[model samples]
Target: MIIELIVCFFATVSFGIIFSVPRNSLLLGGGIGSLAWAIYRLLPEYGVTSIFATSIASITAAMLAHFLARKYRIPATAFTIPGIIPLVPGSKAYYTMLAFVEGDYIGGLELGIVTMLQAGAIAAGIVFALAVFSFGKGIGHRYEGGR
Candidate 1:
């Protein structure tokens, strides 16, 4: 857990750097990314599926992004985009393609399905959070994470 935390924290910071996230927001964005990745890592040990885990973690990331965006007056994408880097299923996608190259059609298909589900879950979760927050803001909630 410690290693995963540290590695993801730095990885998120590096992603922020590469993406040119604002200097004032970079570390906070890294923090959101690290927290989201930690949630993704933790849920699997409890027997939760990766797709569910990814969705939950992504929801958490998006909510945090919205909260922090209002707090700091920065655009939420600065946090949301970098925050999801660690949750991306890069290795799974790679192996899915590799299986096809190795003539393992069934294996490739299974992996491809799971990978797509995880990706969809991430998108759905982010969108759900966005819609919720947008609705609240539109109604003049003024709920800036407790002001």
Candidate 2:
């Protein structure tokens, strides 16, 4: 588990470096990635399914991304994209495609569906997080005019 967290940090930092993310934000991005990954890994031990775990982690990533962006004045995506790198279901997608190539149509179909659902879950989680953050930010404020 410790190794996994370490790997998550390095992986995110590497991603930040590769993408030319601003130098000052790399450490925080790596931290968000590690924290998101930690939540994803720990929830499974408590009986949560992978899809749900992924969603929760994604939500966490987005929340941190927002905070990081606000605090540092960097675009939230600088953190969000790197933060979710470790959460991508690359293996499942690869296996799904491999199943298709190997002439296992039924297996491929099942794997493909699951892969899509997982991907959708990640998107949904991010969207939900954005909505929650937006709502929170808008509290005690009113839109007065439509222009």
Candidate 3:
């Protein structure tokens, strides 16, 4: 578990550098990625499916991105893009392509579908988080208008 978190942190930080995220924000981005990956890794022990786990992790990461963005006055993408890297289904996508290359149409099809579903889950999670944040922002605005 400790090893996993360490690896995730470095992986996210590397991605943040590659994406040109601000130097001051790299640690926060790495922390977010590690937290999301921790939740993802622990959920499977409790019988949570990969798709649902990925969705949950993405939501958590997105929410953190919003919080960090507001606090640091930077765009949320600085944190989000790198934060979600640890949860990406890279191995599954790789296997899907490998299956196709090996002429296993049925296996490739199955893996492709699963990969698509996982990607959709990640998108749904981000959308859900954004919706919640927007709703809260709207309410805050309404209250401030009365002042």
How many angstroms is residue 7 displaced in model 1 relative to the true structure, after the best TM-score fit? 0.8
Candidate 3 lDDT by residue in tens digits, 1-147: 999899999999999999999999999999999999998898989999988898999999999998889899998889888889998889999999999999999999999998998888888878887887777656545555546
TM-score of 3: 0.90
Q: List runs of model 3 lying over 4 Å from the truth.
A: 136-147
Which residue ranges in model 1 land beyond 4 Å of their true spot? 136-147
Query: What is the lDDT of every predicted structure here?
Result: 0.91, 0.89, 0.91
Residue 139 CA displacement from its true place in model 2, Å: 8.4
Q: Judge candidate 3 at residue 21 and give its lDDT.
A: 95
Error of 2 at 119 (Å): 1.0
Residue 18 accuracy (lDDT) in model 3: 95
Best by TM-score: 1
Q: What's the best-to-worst order under lDDT? A: 1, 3, 2
TM-score of 1: 0.91
Residue 18 C-alpha lDDT in model 2: 98
